[model samples]
Target: MSTETVNPVTGKIDEQALVTKANRQDLRFAIIGFVVLVVVMATLFALVLDFMIDGVPRISGEFLTNYPSRRPEQAGILSAWVGTTLVMSATAMLAIPIGVAAGVYLEEYAPKNWLTDIIEINVTNLAGVPSIIYGLLALGLFVQIFRLGQTILVAGMTLALLILPIIIVATREALRSIPLETREAAFGLGADKWQAVWMYLLPAGRPGILTGVIVGMSRAIGETAPIITIGALTFIAFLPPAPLQDTFPFVNFDWLNSPYTVMPIQMFNWISRPQAGFHVAAAATGVILLSMTLLMNGLAIYIRYRIRRSSR
Candidate 1:
Protein backbone atom coordinates (compact mmCIF):
# COMPACT_ATOMS: atom_id res chain seq x y z
CA MET A 1 0.00 0.00 0.00
CA SER A 2 1.23 3.45 -0.85
CA THR A 3 1.34 6.15 1.86
CA GLU A 4 -0.55 9.42 1.37
CA THR A 5 0.10 12.84 2.89
CA VAL A 6 -3.05 14.88 3.41
CA ASN A 7 -2.54 18.57 2.83
CA PRO A 8 -3.91 20.52 5.78
CA VAL A 9 -4.88 23.57 3.71
CA THR A 10 -5.73 22.05 0.32
CA GLY A 11 -7.25 18.87 1.72
CA LYS A 12 -5.48 16.76 -0.90
CA ILE A 13 -3.51 13.56 -0.55
CA ASP A 14 0.25 14.28 -0.86
CA GLU A 15 2.33 11.66 0.88
CA GLN A 16 5.69 13.15 1.80
CA ALA A 17 8.75 12.41 3.96
CA LEU A 18 8.69 15.93 5.49
CA VAL A 19 8.10 14.78 9.05
CA THR A 20 11.15 12.49 8.89
CA LYS A 21 14.06 14.64 7.60
CA ALA A 22 12.66 17.93 8.92
CA ASN A 23 12.14 16.49 12.38
CA ARG A 24 15.67 15.10 12.50
CA GLN A 25 17.19 18.40 11.30
CA ASP A 26 15.07 20.41 13.70
CA LEU A 27 16.03 18.23 16.63
CA ARG A 28 19.72 18.41 15.75
CA PHE A 29 19.76 22.22 15.51
CA ALA A 30 17.62 22.65 18.63
CA ILE A 31 19.88 20.49 20.76
CA ILE A 32 23.02 22.24 19.49
CA GLY A 33 21.60 25.72 19.93
CA PHE A 34 20.29 24.95 23.41
CA VAL A 35 23.69 23.65 24.52
CA VAL A 36 25.47 26.72 23.19
CA LEU A 37 23.00 29.03 24.86
CA VAL A 38 23.36 27.31 28.21
CA VAL A 39 27.14 27.47 28.07
CA VAL A 40 27.27 31.15 27.12
CA MET A 41 24.68 32.07 29.72
CA ALA A 42 26.45 30.18 32.46
CA THR A 43 29.81 31.76 31.59
CA LEU A 44 28.36 35.26 31.74
CA PHE A 45 26.59 34.54 35.00
CA ALA A 46 29.76 33.19 36.58
CA LEU A 47 31.79 36.22 35.50
CA VAL A 48 29.35 38.74 36.93
CA LEU A 49 28.66 36.68 40.03
CA ASP A 50 32.34 36.93 40.88
CA PHE A 51 31.88 40.67 41.37
CA MET A 52 28.95 40.09 43.71
CA ILE A 53 30.86 37.74 46.01
CA ASP A 54 34.45 38.97 45.78
CA GLY A 55 34.78 39.39 49.53
CA VAL A 56 31.79 38.30 51.54
CA PRO A 57 31.04 35.52 53.94
CA ARG A 58 29.08 33.07 51.80
CA ILE A 59 27.95 30.71 54.53
CA SER A 60 26.39 31.00 57.96
CA GLY A 61 23.55 28.98 59.49
CA GLU A 62 22.27 32.13 61.21
CA PHE A 63 22.07 33.91 57.86
CA LEU A 64 20.07 31.04 56.43
CA THR A 65 17.30 30.95 59.01
CA ASN A 66 17.08 34.37 60.66
CA TYR A 67 14.94 37.28 59.55
CA PRO A 68 16.26 40.21 57.55
CA SER A 69 17.88 43.14 59.30
CA ARG A 70 18.87 46.71 58.63
CA ARG A 71 22.38 45.75 59.64
CA PRO A 72 24.35 44.74 56.58
CA GLU A 73 26.30 41.87 58.08
CA GLN A 74 23.54 40.47 60.25
CA ALA A 75 20.37 39.95 58.22
CA GLY A 76 18.82 36.63 57.14
CA ILE A 77 16.05 35.45 54.85
CA LEU A 78 14.02 33.50 57.41
CA SER A 79 10.90 35.59 57.24
CA ALA A 80 11.03 35.76 53.48
CA TRP A 81 11.50 32.01 53.39
CA VAL A 82 8.41 31.39 55.46
CA GLY A 83 6.53 34.09 53.59
CA THR A 84 7.32 32.64 50.18
CA THR A 85 6.25 29.19 51.34
CA LEU A 86 3.00 30.62 52.69
CA VAL A 87 2.25 32.51 49.50
CA MET A 88 3.10 29.55 47.27
CA SER A 89 1.12 27.08 49.35
CA ALA A 90 -1.80 29.47 49.38
CA THR A 91 -1.53 29.93 45.63
CA ALA A 92 -1.55 26.16 45.12
CA MET A 93 -4.55 25.77 47.38
CA LEU A 94 -6.42 28.32 45.33
CA ALA A 95 -5.26 27.16 41.90
CA ILE A 96 -5.39 23.36 41.99
CA PRO A 97 -9.13 22.80 42.35
CA ILE A 98 -10.19 25.43 39.87
CA GLY A 99 -7.56 24.61 37.28
CA VAL A 100 -7.87 20.83 37.54
CA ALA A 101 -11.64 21.05 37.52
CA ALA A 102 -11.58 23.16 34.39
CA GLY A 103 -9.24 20.66 32.80
CA VAL A 104 -11.55 17.84 33.83
CA TYR A 105 -14.62 19.55 32.43
CA LEU A 106 -12.93 20.37 29.18
CA GLU A 107 -11.10 17.11 28.61
CA GLU A 108 -13.55 14.56 29.95
CA TYR A 109 -16.96 16.04 29.38
CA ALA A 110 -16.90 18.87 26.84
CA PRO A 111 -18.40 18.18 23.45
CA LYS A 112 -16.17 18.32 20.40
CA ASN A 113 -17.66 21.55 19.14
CA TRP A 114 -17.02 25.22 18.64
CA LEU A 115 -17.44 26.12 22.30
CA THR A 116 -14.81 23.72 23.52
CA ASP A 117 -12.52 24.77 20.73
CA ILE A 118 -12.92 28.41 21.69
CA ILE A 119 -12.23 27.62 25.33
CA GLU A 120 -9.10 25.72 24.39
CA ILE A 121 -7.86 28.60 22.26
CA ASN A 122 -8.54 31.04 25.06
CA VAL A 123 -6.62 28.93 27.54
CA THR A 124 -3.61 28.78 25.25
CA ASN A 125 -3.75 32.53 24.67
CA LEU A 126 -3.97 33.25 28.35
CA ALA A 127 -0.88 31.13 29.00
CA GLY A 128 1.09 33.19 26.48
CA VAL A 129 0.16 36.52 28.07
CA PRO A 130 2.94 38.22 30.00
CA SER A 131 3.09 37.36 33.71
CA ILE A 132 3.33 41.01 34.71
CA ILE A 133 -0.11 41.56 33.22
CA TYR A 134 -1.49 39.16 35.77
CA GLY A 135 0.32 41.14 38.43
CA LEU A 136 -1.40 44.27 37.22
CA LEU A 137 -4.70 42.43 37.22
CA ALA A 138 -4.16 41.47 40.84
CA LEU A 139 -3.32 45.06 41.66
CA GLY A 140 -6.30 46.53 39.89
CA LEU A 141 -8.95 43.93 40.58
CA PHE A 142 -8.08 42.04 43.75
CA VAL A 143 -6.93 45.16 45.49
CA GLN A 144 -9.71 47.36 44.24
CA ILE A 145 -12.48 45.21 42.77
CA PHE A 146 -13.92 43.59 45.88
CA ARG A 147 -11.67 45.12 48.49
CA LEU A 148 -9.82 41.98 49.53
CA GLY A 149 -7.01 44.28 50.64
CA GLN A 150 -3.33 43.89 49.82
CA THR A 151 -2.73 40.60 51.51
CA ILE A 152 -1.30 37.13 50.79
CA LEU A 153 -4.79 35.83 50.06
CA VAL A 154 -5.32 38.41 47.37
CA ALA A 155 -1.82 37.95 45.99
CA GLY A 156 -2.25 34.19 45.85
CA MET A 157 -5.66 34.39 44.22
CA THR A 158 -4.20 36.68 41.60
CA LEU A 159 -1.35 34.27 40.88
CA ALA A 160 -3.86 31.43 40.79
CA LEU A 161 -5.66 33.20 37.99
CA LEU A 162 -2.41 33.79 36.18
CA ILE A 163 -1.23 30.17 36.29
CA LEU A 164 -4.57 28.40 36.12
CA PRO A 165 -4.49 28.29 32.35
CA ILE A 166 -1.09 26.66 32.38
CA ILE A 167 -2.28 24.08 34.85
CA ILE A 168 -5.39 23.43 32.81
CA VAL A 169 -3.50 22.97 29.59
CA ALA A 170 -0.92 20.70 31.16
CA THR A 171 -3.64 18.68 32.80
CA ARG A 172 -5.63 18.41 29.60
CA GLU A 173 -2.58 17.17 27.72
CA ALA A 174 -1.91 14.68 30.47
CA LEU A 175 -5.50 13.53 30.42
CA ARG A 176 -5.41 13.16 26.67
CA SER A 177 -2.29 11.02 26.95
CA ILE A 178 -4.30 8.43 28.86
CA PRO A 179 -4.94 5.45 26.61
CA LEU A 180 -8.37 5.64 25.05
CA GLU A 181 -8.76 1.95 25.76
CA THR A 182 -8.57 2.63 29.51
CA ARG A 183 -11.44 5.08 29.32
CA GLU A 184 -13.46 2.64 27.25
CA ALA A 185 -12.77 -0.12 29.72
CA ALA A 186 -13.96 2.02 32.58
CA PHE A 187 -17.06 2.98 30.66
CA GLY A 188 -17.73 -0.62 29.74
CA LEU A 189 -17.67 -1.42 33.45
CA GLY A 190 -20.55 1.07 33.97
CA ALA A 191 -18.31 3.78 35.41
CA ASP A 192 -19.82 7.26 35.17
CA LYS A 193 -17.95 10.06 33.43
CA TRP A 194 -16.91 11.62 36.70
CA GLN A 195 -15.63 8.34 38.06
CA ALA A 196 -13.79 7.48 34.92
CA VAL A 197 -12.16 10.87 34.82
CA TRP A 198 -11.36 11.34 38.48
CA MET A 199 -11.04 7.97 40.18
CA TYR A 200 -9.27 6.38 37.27
CA LEU A 201 -7.96 9.02 34.91
CA LEU A 202 -6.86 11.46 37.57
CA PRO A 203 -4.85 8.87 39.45
CA ALA A 204 -3.28 7.84 36.19
CA GLY A 205 -2.57 11.48 35.41
CA ARG A 206 -1.21 12.39 38.85
CA PRO A 207 2.34 12.74 37.57
CA GLY A 208 1.31 15.29 34.98
CA ILE A 209 -0.88 17.14 37.42
CA LEU A 210 1.90 17.26 39.96
CA THR A 211 4.30 18.42 37.30
CA GLY A 212 1.94 21.20 36.27
CA VAL A 213 1.17 22.24 39.82
CA ILE A 214 4.85 22.41 40.74
CA VAL A 215 5.76 24.42 37.66
CA GLY A 216 2.86 26.81 38.14
CA MET A 217 3.71 27.22 41.78
CA SER A 218 7.34 27.93 40.86
CA ARG A 219 6.19 30.78 38.64
CA ALA A 220 3.94 32.12 41.33
CA ILE A 221 6.71 31.89 43.88
CA GLY A 222 9.17 33.79 41.70
CA GLU A 223 6.62 36.47 40.89
CA THR A 224 7.27 39.84 42.49
CA ALA A 225 5.26 42.31 40.46
CA PRO A 226 1.77 41.12 41.39
CA ILE A 227 2.67 40.79 45.02
CA ILE A 228 4.40 44.15 44.91
CA THR A 229 1.41 45.58 43.14
CA ILE A 230 -0.78 44.11 45.86
CA GLY A 231 1.50 45.75 48.41
CA ALA A 232 3.70 42.89 49.58
CA LEU A 233 5.71 44.31 52.43
CA THR A 234 9.50 44.31 52.66
CA PHE A 235 9.32 43.69 56.36
CA ILE A 236 7.20 41.38 58.44
CA ALA A 237 8.22 40.76 62.01
CA PHE A 238 6.27 37.53 62.34
CA LEU A 239 5.49 34.37 60.39
CA PRO A 240 2.16 34.13 58.59
CA PRO A 241 -0.73 33.11 60.79
CA ALA A 242 -2.62 29.94 59.99
CA PRO A 243 -5.43 30.17 57.43
CA LEU A 244 -8.26 29.35 59.84
CA GLN A 245 -7.98 30.05 63.51
CA ASP A 246 -9.21 32.56 66.02
CA THR A 247 -6.78 32.60 68.94
CA PHE A 248 -5.32 29.34 70.14
CA PRO A 249 -1.77 30.30 71.03
CA PHE A 250 0.32 31.95 68.27
CA VAL A 251 -1.87 31.45 65.23
CA ASN A 252 -4.17 34.15 63.90
CA PHE A 253 -5.81 35.35 60.69
CA ASP A 254 -3.56 38.41 60.59
CA TRP A 255 -1.66 37.16 57.53
CA LEU A 256 -4.73 37.65 55.34
CA ASN A 257 -4.86 41.39 56.05
CA SER A 258 -1.47 42.39 57.35
CA PRO A 259 1.60 43.36 55.33
CA TYR A 260 3.70 40.43 54.06
CA THR A 261 6.89 39.73 52.16
CA VAL A 262 8.23 36.86 50.07
CA MET A 263 11.49 35.44 48.73
CA PRO A 264 11.63 37.22 45.38
CA ILE A 265 10.63 40.51 46.92
CA GLN A 266 13.18 40.08 49.63
CA MET A 267 15.88 39.30 47.11
CA PHE A 268 14.80 42.30 45.03
CA ASN A 269 14.76 44.62 48.00
CA TRP A 270 18.16 43.45 49.18
CA ILE A 271 19.85 43.47 45.79
CA SER A 272 18.73 47.04 45.19
CA ARG A 273 20.74 48.26 48.14
CA PRO A 274 24.23 49.73 47.71
CA GLN A 275 26.03 47.54 50.24
CA ALA A 276 28.21 44.58 49.34
CA GLY A 277 26.67 42.58 52.17
CA PHE A 278 23.25 43.04 50.66
CA HIS A 279 24.58 41.84 47.35
CA VAL A 280 25.94 38.67 48.95
CA ALA A 281 22.59 38.16 50.64
CA ALA A 282 21.01 38.48 47.22
CA ALA A 283 23.28 35.75 45.87
CA ALA A 284 22.40 33.50 48.76
CA THR A 285 18.75 34.19 48.12
CA GLY A 286 19.25 33.27 44.49
CA VAL A 287 20.78 29.96 45.54
CA ILE A 288 17.86 29.33 47.86
CA LEU A 289 15.28 30.07 45.20
CA LEU A 290 17.14 27.96 42.68
CA SER A 291 17.37 25.14 45.16
CA MET A 292 13.66 25.31 45.88
CA THR A 293 12.67 25.14 42.22
CA LEU A 294 15.09 22.32 41.48
CA LEU A 295 13.99 20.41 44.53
CA MET A 296 10.36 20.65 43.53
CA ASN A 297 11.13 19.57 39.99
CA GLY A 298 13.20 16.66 41.16
CA LEU A 299 10.55 15.53 43.59
CA ALA A 300 7.87 15.72 40.94
CA ILE A 301 9.98 13.60 38.59
CA TYR A 302 10.68 11.08 41.31
CA ILE A 303 7.05 10.77 42.22
CA ARG A 304 6.06 10.42 38.60
CA TYR A 305 8.61 7.72 38.08
CA ARG A 306 7.49 5.82 41.12
CA ILE A 307 3.84 6.07 40.17
CA ARG A 308 4.44 4.96 36.61
CA ARG A 309 6.61 2.06 37.70
CA SER A 310 4.02 0.88 40.18
CA SER A 311 1.18 1.20 37.67
CA ARG A 312 3.08 -1.03 35.31
Candidate 2:
Protein backbone atom coordinates (compact mmCIF):
# COMPACT_ATOMS: atom_id res chain seq x y z
CA MET A 1 0.00 0.00 0.00
CA SER A 2 1.34 3.45 -0.89
CA THR A 3 0.85 6.35 1.53
CA GLU A 4 0.64 10.03 0.61
CA THR A 5 3.24 12.36 2.16
CA VAL A 6 2.88 16.02 3.26
CA ASN A 7 5.53 18.46 2.04
CA PRO A 8 6.71 20.38 5.10
CA VAL A 9 8.10 23.29 3.09
CA THR A 10 4.83 24.12 1.29
CA GLY A 11 2.59 22.48 3.87
CA LYS A 12 0.83 20.60 1.04
CA ILE A 13 -0.30 17.00 1.20
CA ASP A 14 -0.52 14.96 -2.01
CA GLU A 15 -4.31 15.09 -1.87
CA GLN A 16 -4.39 18.72 -0.61
CA ALA A 17 -2.97 19.95 -3.94
CA LEU A 18 -6.23 18.89 -5.52
CA VAL A 19 -8.21 20.87 -2.89
CA THR A 20 -6.02 23.93 -3.51
CA LYS A 21 -6.77 23.78 -7.19
CA ALA A 22 -10.51 23.83 -6.44
CA ASN A 23 -10.02 26.84 -4.10
CA ARG A 24 -8.23 28.74 -6.83
CA GLN A 25 -11.23 28.10 -9.07
CA ASP A 26 -13.50 29.49 -6.31
CA LEU A 27 -11.72 32.89 -6.41
CA ARG A 28 -13.23 33.55 -9.83
CA PHE A 29 -16.68 33.63 -8.22
CA ALA A 30 -15.43 36.23 -5.72
CA ILE A 31 -14.25 38.44 -8.57
CA ILE A 32 -17.75 38.27 -10.03
CA GLY A 33 -19.18 39.31 -6.65
CA PHE A 34 -16.79 42.30 -6.47
CA VAL A 35 -17.69 43.45 -9.98
CA VAL A 36 -21.39 43.25 -9.12
CA LEU A 37 -20.78 45.41 -6.04
CA VAL A 38 -18.95 48.09 -8.02
CA VAL A 39 -21.72 48.22 -10.63
CA VAL A 40 -24.42 48.60 -7.96
CA MET A 41 -22.49 51.42 -6.23
CA ALA A 42 -21.96 53.24 -9.51
CA THR A 43 -25.64 52.98 -10.41
CA LEU A 44 -26.65 54.37 -7.03
CA PHE A 45 -24.20 57.26 -7.38
CA ALA A 46 -25.54 58.20 -10.80
CA LEU A 47 -29.06 58.27 -9.43
CA VAL A 48 -28.10 60.53 -6.52
CA LEU A 49 -25.61 62.90 -8.15
CA ASP A 50 -26.84 66.39 -8.87
CA PHE A 51 -24.62 66.51 -11.96
CA MET A 52 -26.47 63.54 -13.44
CA ILE A 53 -29.65 65.58 -13.96
CA ASP A 54 -30.26 66.40 -17.64
CA GLY A 55 -29.09 69.87 -18.84
CA VAL A 56 -28.54 72.08 -15.79
CA PRO A 57 -25.28 74.03 -15.44
CA ARG A 58 -25.44 75.51 -11.95
CA ILE A 59 -21.76 75.67 -11.09
CA SER A 60 -20.80 79.23 -11.95
CA GLY A 61 -17.88 81.13 -10.34
CA GLU A 62 -20.34 83.09 -8.22
CA PHE A 63 -22.11 79.90 -7.21
CA LEU A 64 -18.86 78.47 -5.91
CA THR A 65 -18.04 81.40 -3.63
CA ASN A 66 -20.88 83.93 -3.51
CA TYR A 67 -23.16 84.74 -0.63
CA PRO A 68 -26.69 83.39 -0.45
CA SER A 69 -29.05 85.41 -2.62
CA ARG A 70 -32.76 85.92 -2.11
CA ARG A 71 -33.00 84.60 -5.62
CA PRO A 72 -32.42 80.87 -5.32
CA GLU A 73 -30.90 81.06 -8.80
CA GLN A 74 -28.17 83.40 -7.55
CA ALA A 75 -27.46 81.85 -4.16
CA GLY A 76 -23.92 80.54 -3.52
CA ILE A 77 -22.61 78.71 -0.47
CA LEU A 78 -20.01 81.20 0.78
CA SER A 79 -21.45 81.55 4.26
CA ALA A 80 -21.73 77.80 4.43
CA TRP A 81 -18.10 77.66 3.47
CA VAL A 82 -17.26 79.75 6.51
CA GLY A 83 -19.59 77.76 8.68
CA THR A 84 -18.08 74.44 7.70
CA THR A 85 -14.57 75.71 8.27
CA LEU A 86 -15.54 77.00 11.68
CA VAL A 87 -17.39 73.85 12.64
CA MET A 88 -14.54 71.57 11.61
CA SER A 89 -12.00 73.77 13.34
CA ALA A 90 -14.08 73.67 16.49
CA THR A 91 -14.72 69.93 16.24
CA ALA A 92 -11.01 69.25 15.78
CA MET A 93 -10.20 71.48 18.72
CA LEU A 94 -12.45 69.54 21.01
CA ALA A 95 -12.25 66.03 19.58
CA ILE A 96 -8.51 65.43 19.07
CA PRO A 97 -7.03 66.09 22.50
CA ILE A 98 -9.94 64.70 24.47
CA GLY A 99 -10.43 61.59 22.38
CA VAL A 100 -6.76 60.76 21.97
CA ALA A 101 -6.02 61.39 25.63
CA ALA A 102 -8.86 59.15 26.73
CA GLY A 103 -7.67 56.47 24.35
CA VAL A 104 -4.14 56.70 25.67
CA TYR A 105 -5.40 56.33 29.19
CA LEU A 106 -7.46 53.29 28.38
CA GLU A 107 -4.70 51.64 26.46
CA GLU A 108 -1.79 52.48 28.73
CA TYR A 109 -3.29 52.97 32.16
CA ALA A 110 -6.66 51.28 32.28
CA PRO A 111 -7.00 47.99 34.14
CA LYS A 112 -9.01 45.09 32.87
CA ASN A 113 -12.14 45.44 34.91
CA TRP A 114 -15.91 45.45 34.47
CA LEU A 115 -16.00 49.25 34.47
CA THR A 116 -13.51 49.44 31.65
CA ASP A 117 -15.40 46.72 29.84
CA ILE A 118 -18.63 48.69 30.10
CA ILE A 119 -16.89 51.84 28.88
CA GLU A 120 -15.40 50.03 25.93
CA ILE A 121 -18.78 48.54 25.07
CA ASN A 122 -20.57 51.87 25.29
CA VAL A 123 -17.97 53.67 23.21
CA THR A 124 -18.23 51.03 20.47
CA ASN A 125 -22.04 51.17 20.53
CA LEU A 126 -22.09 54.98 20.51
CA ALA A 127 -20.21 55.00 17.23
CA GLY A 128 -23.08 53.12 15.56
CA VAL A 129 -25.94 55.31 16.81
CA PRO A 130 -27.59 57.50 14.21
CA SER A 131 -26.15 61.00 13.78
CA ILE A 132 -29.63 62.38 14.34
CA ILE A 133 -29.74 60.89 17.79
CA TYR A 134 -26.41 62.56 18.58
CA GLY A 135 -27.86 65.81 17.26
CA LEU A 136 -30.85 65.40 19.52
CA LEU A 137 -28.55 64.76 22.43
CA ALA A 138 -26.63 67.93 21.63
CA LEU A 139 -29.86 69.88 21.42
CA GLY A 140 -31.02 68.60 24.78
CA LEU A 141 -27.74 68.62 26.66
CA PHE A 142 -25.39 71.29 25.30
CA VAL A 143 -28.07 73.67 24.13
CA GLN A 144 -30.62 73.05 26.87
CA ILE A 145 -28.58 71.94 29.85
CA PHE A 146 -25.92 74.62 29.76
CA ARG A 147 -28.01 77.02 27.71
CA LEU A 148 -25.34 77.49 25.06
CA GLY A 149 -28.06 78.43 22.56
CA GLN A 150 -28.26 77.16 18.97
CA THR A 151 -25.00 78.73 17.94
CA ILE A 152 -21.86 77.31 16.34
CA LEU A 153 -20.27 76.74 19.73
CA VAL A 154 -23.08 74.45 20.78
CA ALA A 155 -23.02 72.58 17.49
CA GLY A 156 -19.25 72.18 17.61
CA MET A 157 -19.33 70.71 21.09
CA THR A 158 -22.07 68.34 20.06
CA LEU A 159 -20.15 67.17 17.03
CA ALA A 160 -17.09 66.78 19.17
CA LEU A 161 -18.98 64.27 21.27
CA LEU A 162 -20.18 62.42 18.21
CA ILE A 163 -16.65 61.84 16.93
CA LEU A 164 -15.06 61.26 20.32
CA PRO A 165 -15.74 57.54 20.47
CA ILE A 166 -14.29 57.00 17.05
CA ILE A 167 -11.02 58.73 17.89
CA ILE A 168 -10.69 56.80 21.12
CA VAL A 169 -11.17 53.45 19.42
CA ALA A 170 -8.63 54.30 16.73
CA THR A 171 -6.11 55.50 19.28
CA ARG A 172 -6.44 52.26 21.22
CA GLU A 173 -5.91 50.18 18.12
CA ALA A 174 -2.80 52.18 17.27
CA LEU A 175 -1.45 51.85 20.75
CA ARG A 176 -2.18 48.13 20.80
CA SER A 177 -0.28 47.67 17.57
CA ILE A 178 2.97 48.65 19.36
CA PRO A 179 4.88 45.50 20.15
CA LEU A 180 4.99 44.28 23.77
CA GLU A 181 8.76 43.99 23.39
CA THR A 182 8.93 47.73 22.91
CA ARG A 183 7.21 48.34 26.21
CA GLU A 184 9.40 45.81 28.03
CA ALA A 185 12.51 47.34 26.49
CA ALA A 186 11.48 50.73 27.76
CA PHE A 187 10.95 49.22 31.17
CA GLY A 188 14.34 47.61 30.97
CA LEU A 189 15.87 50.98 30.16
CA GLY A 190 14.67 52.34 33.54
CA ALA A 191 11.95 54.46 31.93
CA ASP A 192 8.67 54.74 33.81
CA LYS A 193 5.55 53.23 32.26
CA TRP A 194 4.08 56.64 31.41
CA GLN A 195 7.35 57.73 29.86
CA ALA A 196 7.59 54.52 27.85
CA VAL A 197 4.12 55.01 26.43
CA TRP A 198 4.54 58.70 25.83
CA MET A 199 7.85 58.29 24.03
CA TYR A 200 7.31 55.11 22.01
CA LEU A 201 3.65 54.14 22.04
CA LEU A 202 2.43 57.59 21.11
CA PRO A 203 4.85 57.93 18.19
CA ALA A 204 3.90 54.48 16.95
CA GLY A 205 0.22 55.26 17.31
CA ARG A 206 0.44 58.80 15.98
CA PRO A 207 -0.34 57.70 12.46
CA GLY A 208 -3.47 55.88 13.48
CA ILE A 209 -4.59 58.82 15.59
CA LEU A 210 -4.05 61.26 12.76
CA THR A 211 -5.85 59.00 10.30
CA GLY A 212 -8.76 58.50 12.69
CA VAL A 213 -9.21 62.20 13.37
CA ILE A 214 -9.10 63.03 9.67
CA VAL A 215 -11.69 60.35 8.93
CA GLY A 216 -13.82 61.59 11.81
CA MET A 217 -13.46 65.17 10.62
CA SER A 218 -14.41 64.09 7.11
CA ARG A 219 -17.72 62.76 8.41
CA ALA A 220 -18.12 65.76 10.67
CA ILE A 221 -17.68 68.07 7.69
CA GLY A 222 -20.57 66.38 5.89
CA GLU A 223 -22.83 66.32 8.97
CA THR A 224 -25.72 68.68 8.25
CA ALA A 225 -28.39 67.00 10.31
CA PRO A 226 -26.69 67.52 13.67
CA ILE A 227 -25.63 71.07 12.98
CA ILE A 228 -29.07 71.81 11.53
CA THR A 229 -30.71 70.45 14.64
CA ILE A 230 -28.43 72.72 16.64
CA GLY A 231 -29.56 75.68 14.51
CA ALA A 232 -26.90 76.02 11.88
CA LEU A 233 -28.84 78.59 9.85
CA THR A 234 -29.54 77.29 6.34
CA PHE A 235 -28.52 80.57 4.72
CA ILE A 236 -26.29 83.34 5.94
CA ALA A 237 -24.85 86.04 3.73
CA PHE A 238 -21.94 87.07 5.95
CA LEU A 239 -18.56 85.50 6.45
CA PRO A 240 -18.17 84.65 10.11
CA PRO A 241 -16.01 87.08 12.02
CA ALA A 242 -12.52 86.02 12.95
CA PRO A 243 -12.26 84.65 16.47
CA LEU A 244 -11.84 87.28 19.19
CA GLN A 245 -11.65 86.85 22.91
CA ASP A 246 -11.24 89.72 25.35
CA THR A 247 -9.93 87.44 28.06
CA PHE A 248 -7.69 85.47 25.81
CA PRO A 249 -6.69 88.90 24.39
CA PHE A 250 -6.23 87.66 20.83
CA VAL A 251 -8.66 84.80 20.38
CA ASN A 252 -11.93 85.62 18.69
CA PHE A 253 -14.97 83.58 19.66
CA ASP A 254 -16.95 84.65 16.55
CA TRP A 255 -14.94 82.02 14.75
CA LEU A 256 -16.28 79.70 17.41
CA ASN A 257 -19.64 81.10 18.61
CA SER A 258 -21.40 82.75 15.71
CA PRO A 259 -24.39 81.43 13.81
CA TYR A 260 -22.59 79.27 11.28
CA THR A 261 -23.27 77.12 8.24
CA VAL A 262 -21.08 74.49 6.57
CA MET A 263 -20.81 73.23 3.02
CA PRO A 264 -23.12 70.27 3.59
CA ILE A 265 -25.80 72.41 5.21
CA GLN A 266 -25.47 74.93 2.41
CA MET A 267 -25.74 72.21 -0.22
CA PHE A 268 -28.76 70.89 1.58
CA ASN A 269 -30.31 74.31 1.65
CA TRP A 270 -29.77 74.57 -2.10
CA ILE A 271 -31.02 71.09 -2.87
CA SER A 272 -34.29 71.72 -1.05
CA ARG A 273 -35.09 74.75 -3.20
CA PRO A 274 -37.73 74.48 -5.88
CA GLN A 275 -35.34 75.91 -8.48
CA ALA A 276 -33.54 73.66 -10.99
CA GLY A 277 -30.42 75.84 -10.89
CA PHE A 278 -30.08 75.29 -7.16
CA HIS A 279 -30.10 71.56 -7.83
CA VAL A 280 -27.08 71.95 -10.06
CA ALA A 281 -25.43 74.07 -7.41
CA ALA A 282 -26.04 71.23 -5.00
CA ALA A 283 -24.08 68.85 -7.22
CA ALA A 284 -21.24 71.32 -7.46
CA THR A 285 -21.27 71.61 -3.70
CA GLY A 286 -20.93 67.84 -3.49
CA VAL A 287 -17.89 68.00 -5.73
CA ILE A 288 -16.33 70.52 -3.41
CA LEU A 289 -17.07 68.33 -0.42
CA LEU A 290 -15.66 65.22 -2.06
CA SER A 291 -12.51 67.15 -2.81
CA MET A 292 -12.07 68.24 0.79
CA THR A 293 -12.67 64.75 2.17
CA LEU A 294 -10.17 63.29 -0.26
CA LEU A 295 -7.64 65.92 0.72
CA MET A 296 -8.01 65.09 4.37
CA ASN A 297 -7.67 61.37 3.72
CA GLY A 298 -4.55 62.07 1.70
CA LEU A 299 -3.02 64.13 4.46
CA ALA A 300 -3.69 61.39 6.95
CA ILE A 301 -2.08 58.81 4.68
CA TYR A 302 0.95 60.99 4.16
CA ILE A 303 1.39 61.54 7.88
CA ARG A 304 1.09 57.81 8.57
CA TYR A 305 3.59 56.93 5.88
CA ARG A 306 6.10 59.52 7.01
CA ILE A 307 5.89 58.41 10.64
CA ARG A 308 6.17 54.74 9.75
CA ARG A 309 9.19 55.44 7.60
CA SER A 310 10.88 57.43 10.35
CA SER A 311 10.19 54.70 12.88
CA ARG A 312 11.49 52.03 10.57
Indicate which candidate wins on TM-score. 2
Q: Compared with the true structure, what per-residue lDDT tens digits does model 1 show for residues 206-296?
A: 7888888888887777777767777888876677765666556645656766557898899899889999888888777777776677687
Which has the greatest lDDT? 2
- C-alpha RMSD values across all candidates: 8.9, 6.7
Clashing pairs in 2: 83-261, 84-262, 243-252, 244-251, 244-252, 244-253, 245-251
Can you give the TM-score per candidate against the true fold?
0.79, 0.82
lDDT of 2 at 15: 70
Q: Tell me how many clashing residue pairs each candidate has.
A: 2, 7
